[model samples]
Target chain A: MSEPIPLLMTLAYVAVALWLGVRARGSHRMDSLEQWGVAGRSMGPVVMYLLMGAGSISAYTFMGAPGWAWSKGVPVFYVVIYLSYLALIAWYCGPRVWAFGARLGHVTQAQAVADRFESPLLGALTSLVMSIGAMAYAVLQTIGAAYILEVMSGGLLPFTLNIWLVLGTIAIYLFISGQRAIGVTNAFQGGLMLIVAWTIGLWAAHRLTGDWWFGGVFERLRDTHIDFLTLPGGLGDMSFAFWTSSIIVSMFSFQQPVWLQWMSADSAQSIRRSASWLPTYYFVILPMVVVGFIGIFSLPDLERADTVALQLAFQQMPPILVGLLGAGTLAAAMSSSEPYIHGTALTWTRDVIRPLFKLSERRTGQLARYLIFPIMLLIVGPVAMLNPGNLIMILLVGLGFAAQMLPAFIGLFVWPRATRTGVLCGLSAGFIVTALFTVVWPNPLGVHAGAWGLIVNLPLFVAVSRVTRPASDATLARFMAIVAPRRPTSRSAGEREPTSSTIT
Target chain B: MNHRLIRPATRRGKALLALFLLVILAGLWPAVLLANHAVLILGLPALAAWSCLIILASTGVMLLANRLLPLPTSITQADPTKAASGPGERVDE
Candidate 1:
């Protein structure tokens, strides 16, 4: 009774996730590439909403979020600030993805852009860059899962085995069941994580104040020179820079492979339905901040910030609850990792294989499967060996690079005159600025480099687009129809339902 | 097509659903006080009897809500064909 019951319960949660994945695999329809990658584009609003929401709230939600709360105090709440804005983006960006996916037959973000640009080379390049970056990010997640396992088991199992088992199981099951597995699992995982996250939050709040009032936590937070609840905590150089940069940069930049989940929705209304609720789902996280505050007081001398969640659960909560926390963490990792691997395979097949070889539908599907194993091996080994240092720097760099895709997607939607050359130039400029920001300055001019780069990137897109000759009227119309408010019928000059053979 | 849910379906249905779920979930923990001869389970100062009841009840309510809620129509997915051809055009299978 003295020790927490986290271990046994976590094992049970793990077993349930694995069993669910196995059951989903039995019902899998892997004959078509669409089923394999995009979940058959039949997902309804509730499922789509949960998958995307769970997908977004990954190891980052479980560990990184609480950790950020532990270290930065209240300021980390800035991350959740975008929930509403992100929902807005989903409302707008999601339906367009569906429209375009239906018409252009897109399976990945790379395809959406390449099809719009009418250049496989552009598609290939975008896919290559995104795949490389996303693979690294996936590895980060695998490492995160392993780290939690090591702490939860008290070193009974090595971190490396945990990484291999967790990641390998996810990849294998995903390869078997594809997006259907991901959707169902994400819904379950999202619900579980929500329960666990709030439970910990409420429990911690109750402990500190002997009630659920915020006064004690707020007072304790205010006592910290860095009250995390406020901005510009007297860190003149870093605070303002981190806050403004993360908000703007993350808003514009983050283009993970899972954005394609919008395309998998059963209908246009599903997009809006999912969008409406998904952002509000973030309300579960306020308790996480309370947990972080408790960590500040409860485990005053912890070495690593990420370990805060584990330490608190083990040190304070009952065992069954700890297991519940483990289940939540595992859900975050799996929901995110399954989509990443699925997207990696899609990117590899469409961006790399198709452009160079011009493969047929059947062959393209085969090669995609071939690509998955190597990508798995690529992440599992190197990520396990690397220790987490300067995580904030890594997160910032990833965000900056991801932001570059925004200009291209936005341009396709709004500016009919945006030309291929202009897009190329805009992408180059954004990438160069983001790379420099990520590498050289890390923090420059008291602001996030990605935000600064995006400021620079936006004008270049507009300037180049206006100056360059627009694509032919027909090409422009084709692109516009996808983003148009009304759905295009076959009577439209150029409209098509997606199939296995679409080049994108 | 009424084109909206009961009462014109303000754009906030999804958000409100999530909010409602949270309140019910949070209330479950405190409901431990409602149980008789409160016995501790999992080392928490709560009743095991109440905890299991709350879990089953919450899960049941969610499932019922899901079944009862009306499904929104998806326009882009209804694929019937008018035969025509263009580059990158969608075709019905």
Candidate 2:
């Protein structure tokens, strides 16, 4: 009887999520690509804040962070560090991206980059790279969702069925409502995840150590496993170089494809406001980390460290709490997964297929909506079924690829001298180096493979830009005016104003 | 709440930028190594406490930056089709 309760609660959560997704299509016509792709850029600060926050904190934080804490110890703090900086990155970059999207009718990150350099091929390349990254992320989250249900239900739900149930719910709602469904559902899931994280974290600590304050847990660990509380961690693998490099690579990789869409889905002020408050949401990780530390003494030498939190839930928590944990973990997985699935389809259609086929706006939007089904069922579904690699490692590998786009972003936002040829060459070089290091050697010399990519990418970009012709001066002026508009001086006031275009 | 954009050239903008860099540095490498100990601070590990503090500091810095450097009117108020077009005709989408 108790076995059925956890599965029922998880199913109930799924039912409510599906209802919310179906109901999210309220009032909007959902006729245009802009309306469907970005919720017509109408999300307010509260919803956008939750959407961005939930989207960033995925199954990685729910399961992976605790797993690392349990296995490696203080090294897992890199998650906290990188996430804090991500909000800062968003605060500074979100307004500019939103302004570009709103004023120039840009819908995707690749579109903005391609426009900056006047290169359709460049945009296609970017779209492909970003699609791969998004697919990897989606696969990770699907595996996470399936794992949560399987663990929570005592294997009754099974991994294979859970994947279908999880992805099917997301694909249906996404097909029906697009970005609006993501925003509404993420807001609800984000709140649920925070509550569940703190509840389970504190409960585990109190039940194990008889102290709700977490001091007792630390004191015991210090007495028994002192290395767990220090650098190099329990496994002795998280060296200074590894920790620092991981943080840097993760921080730079925060400009994710889906996040760019999220930034574009609101007013500049609303985006900035949401970014300013988003870091506080990262406090959700604190208790989850504590839960990992609690696992050290209670269930040592586990075969799979990622399941530490769930294992504790099953051992110490009552059936109802276990069900809530399942729901929250599922929420984390689904909320993050939806955006990537939607983003992959949107970018693939708009940047790749549309340009290749010269499709009309109406036709392109229709194609993007239709592409969601195959992406989930055919691509993401099969990869997730394999349950490929460790959760954190998969995240890092995808981020490594995403980080290569840094040079393109520099051309868009900061440096006016960045040429199309230079960006393309630099991005290509970065990708090769990253792929080689990530797969061939895997973090040589204690630094992250992604950082190794950037080390080579940036200088090559500068050298190539110096040799190659820059964007036409007129193009530079138009682009700069929007991103870095000059002050209205009496002399400059006579200059031509920035150009704009209608959303196609 | 202020609608005016504060260019990154300003003193406040420079200060905020510096603060951002400092906060990031505080959480990595040589700076983090200082707090990498088994000692407890307010019940949490010293390293954990330091990392958490850095995150809090980052939040404070971003909030300060937001107040000091609001977005420009061109960004905040311009219509997509009618806003200033700089020097060139619009590039084809």
Candidate 3:
């Protein structure tokens, strides 16, 4: 039966993931903190390439994107544009972050901030912000993975059971091996995701546009669903400003805990190599888009638009591959979730608990390990089962929260005047305004609440920093040397060189 | 093939940076109204194709800029321990 084929494939995939996690502890002595936390900061181009690129593409790319395409149409293409911008951002920020981490022995994003500004309090707050986003993201992945399992299995699997099994499996693998396991599995999962997305997308495109195989449906959609082809979003669900603002926010929103993965690479060059290939990966959405566009024509009466992609695959594709599709979707979910859970654990140890208690590195790592399960079980697990809204909603809110950290980051390397008070004040103000507009105020002038919040956030950062005492020159010289020079069209000697009292 | 991150020094690299900024700016909130068009290209509407074009162009620019960086060694990530301790390579104001 079709049911068993997918279920069996999913189980096989789980076995490989577990095996990869166990074997990930190979050769490398993970006794040192960097080794365990960041795979010794030694991942080469191939591994780093897969790890960073994979982090950007989550199960949402497979699950929620198609649903957006099915309902909203042309706006879904924003996924490709935003990811392309994210890659460009890495080309700019990745090297600098890696340089700071490599030079300062910083393993986490918050550590970089804490060291730069000489404020452990700021570091803790930054990590807390990132942790909140990660938990939401992890839960989003859990819900997505569960949805794929339940939907693909034709009700043979239930959402509640699927949640426990998926989260439990992810937790075990992450707890055992840490970042190394994630890097290895990402290579496998990233490759699988690309192939599966291409196969299904191209196949669906060919089938749906039958007789007019190349793109006959284009003309047909123009005739009928013109609104779908034109944007501001289908049926005016999203305005033009919404699409544009979302792209700007999402592109720069790569400031999540995954910056740790950037630092884990063997060299900044590896991160650069990966960025070059990232735009191509964004094409994975092309197939998802094609499938969703077809679903608009084919599966019109479905209760939930999110179910369209899975339904079409089962209806049109052979039964044997449906299970494989289920597994691939699960891969998308796990690839992202594992890192988030680990990132949360690290943040708890490095930023919050360690700073307060002054624990040794080993003890901190132990405490980090201790918190992993409770985070998964008590927080992410519950939210996944009884989510407040759909997958995209949670994801958007998480992204908005992540974006709140950007001003602080930009200040760290770009402007010397950005003080601790400035960053702290700007961050809270931005978050409050964004949260208010996003949840409470609702449709603040038809723009994304985050966009409106940024209007308040950027200026506040600038104003507060101007009035506050700037960082000591020694502090600025060390952190600014790498990234300050990278800024386009800026060639000041001061920006390129450090103040004399520092390392030089 | 050169695995280096981008920098802005040379005329070519600066131009590439300009192109990247121009394109990204063109895609912001004000420009979204212009992007919403009904014309079709290979089964997608004009707006969709426009987004694809922006990404493709930006990728080309990024690749070009990275390839033109002055310090190849600086572009590559350094080993953590040496990087942390080595003051000789550190910049002097």
Candidate 4:
């Protein structure tokens, strides 16, 4: 149980990740913004599947879900519910997004929305809000990775050093290889995490309760802490209303800027195929949740609930398994963080900077490549070191903000009648209401603030669109022609079908 | 099972959508309350067991939908020239 074994194992994992990233750069020339941002839209189903699957299940799954299970109990199962729906949303939306990106060259989500409504100001606004959400997510992962490293090293690697180390590794590869690096590294990390999660989960359960199955663990919990098995969980704060609202908000929040880049696969079919299989990955959460429950009895009175799994590993498991757990947790954190970091730079430069300053595409791409450093070192690194909030709460807040972009999504993919003004007003209102309720009033009447925001947002959006002027017919036709094309009329059957060029 | 009654693809899509909604409702407030007992089913709590069942159901439906629907044509075919140049060139602007 020497400390050096765990530290060496973690360092080896980091080395492997860097190797995969550098190797991924060998396949493509990272010249353009499209290449750097979305891997030149050339990713196939396998890479896209692993990338999207791993990206969506982040440090939140490894740390926050276990933390919530340890602290609040069954309410943590809300993550399971929302994640299941997230795949369904991806199945429905991924194809449309891929089609739009392929046909129109959209590397970032804001670019598509801006073009749909023909409003650069809306694009800039969307970029700003999405950047805030992205930063929150990155910071959350950073803190989780640092904590794991510190514990696995038996306090040899301090949190401050670990935080910089985590960000530095991500920055180097992300700067060199971009989305290609993310795709390769995430695939390896994704496979590693699934294996490590199951091993730790079953081993922990067996060691704690003398059974590999979770039924015994639940039975023990039910007899002693009945509240842990039901809604409004152990803390009595996660009421049914809050749980339901959180699920709904999380479903919409799945459409983060990074996901759009992930969906920029070589074909719409690859995206859809990958999405249909993505939900199965949610099985990874079950084992992590079990680890958390085991912690309730095995490691009671832990200071930080998020570190319960690692703490338990150190106390009971052999040093090898402890080192493996450390590496797996870091994999989950870095897999999620790389995309957010890459997406943030792409969103800021392409959607915000380029359009605002009228920069050329070449210039924008170069700037985005360079912007990754300051974003990681100056912004995400410092905030993560400060450890601003709890793991799950930080995740929820970011998703709530990202969920405000629902109106823009409607304009892009579903309702063509949605005007620029309606989306602008609705997004602004939703963001304000969500922020106020989240920070000030804070989940009034046991309903999540995001749900309250949406309750106000939808009606206002519809009412405003009913009165305001919608997008120009050409713009609307351009979008409809891509997402929902008309069946060809007999008179026009003989002519060349109207492609993206017709509207333009 | 009833291709005569409805287009198989459309029916499958509807069924998939319906199953998704059912999972959501089953996992939420009123419906979840029905299974919120400490009672164990197959080595897990009632609600935990229910959540796992729905997750399995969700994966099954998605697989069924993928199999039923015809593979869509590549949308990239609409703009071969732009697709070849990579997704860097601005089409509309």
C-alpha DockQ of every model: 0.05, 0.33, 0.27, 0.27
lDDT of each: 0.63, 0.79, 0.73, 0.77
Which prediction has more favorable TM-score, 2 or 3?
2
Determine which window of 10 residues in candidate 1 chain B has minimal summed lDDT. B1-10
Candidate 4 docking band: acceptable
Put down candidate 1 lDDT per residue, A317-362, tens digits, no spaces. 7777777788788778777777777787887786677767777656
Q: Which ten residues in a row have the lowest lDDT in candidate 4 chain A?
A: A495-504
lDDT of 2 at A326: 87
Clashes of 2: 7
Give lDDT tens digits, candidate 2, residues A1-504: 357777788888999999999899888866556767887777888988888888888988878899999998888888888888888888777777777766667777777777788887888888888777778888888988988888777777789998998999998889888888998899899999999999998888889888887889889989988999998999998889889888888887744444555544557788778877888888899899999999999889789898898888888889888888889889999998889888888888888888877887778888888899999889889888887766446556567878888888777766777888888888888888888888789889988899999899989998998789877666666566666675332223423332121000
Runs with alpha carbons beyond 4 Å of true place in candidate 1? A1-5, A26-28, A223-226, A234-238, A388-395, A485-504, B1-86, B89-93
> B3-93, model 1: which lDDT tens digit per residue?
0111112234344455434424332223322432222333221222233333344334333433443322232543312112245522111
The reply for model 4, stretches above 4 Å from the true place, is A254-257, A389-397, A487-504, B1-16, B71-93
lDDT of 3 by residue, A279-340 (tens): 76777777777677788889988888877778888888876667767888899998988889
Residues A149-218, candidate 4, lDDT per residue (tens digit)? 8877778889999999988888888888988899889989989889989999999888878997787888
Candidate 2 DockQ, CA atoms = 0.33
Tell me the deviation in Å of residue A402 in model 2. 0.9
Residue A437 lDDT (model 2): 87
Least well predicted 10-residue stretch by lDDT in candidate 1 chain A: A495-504
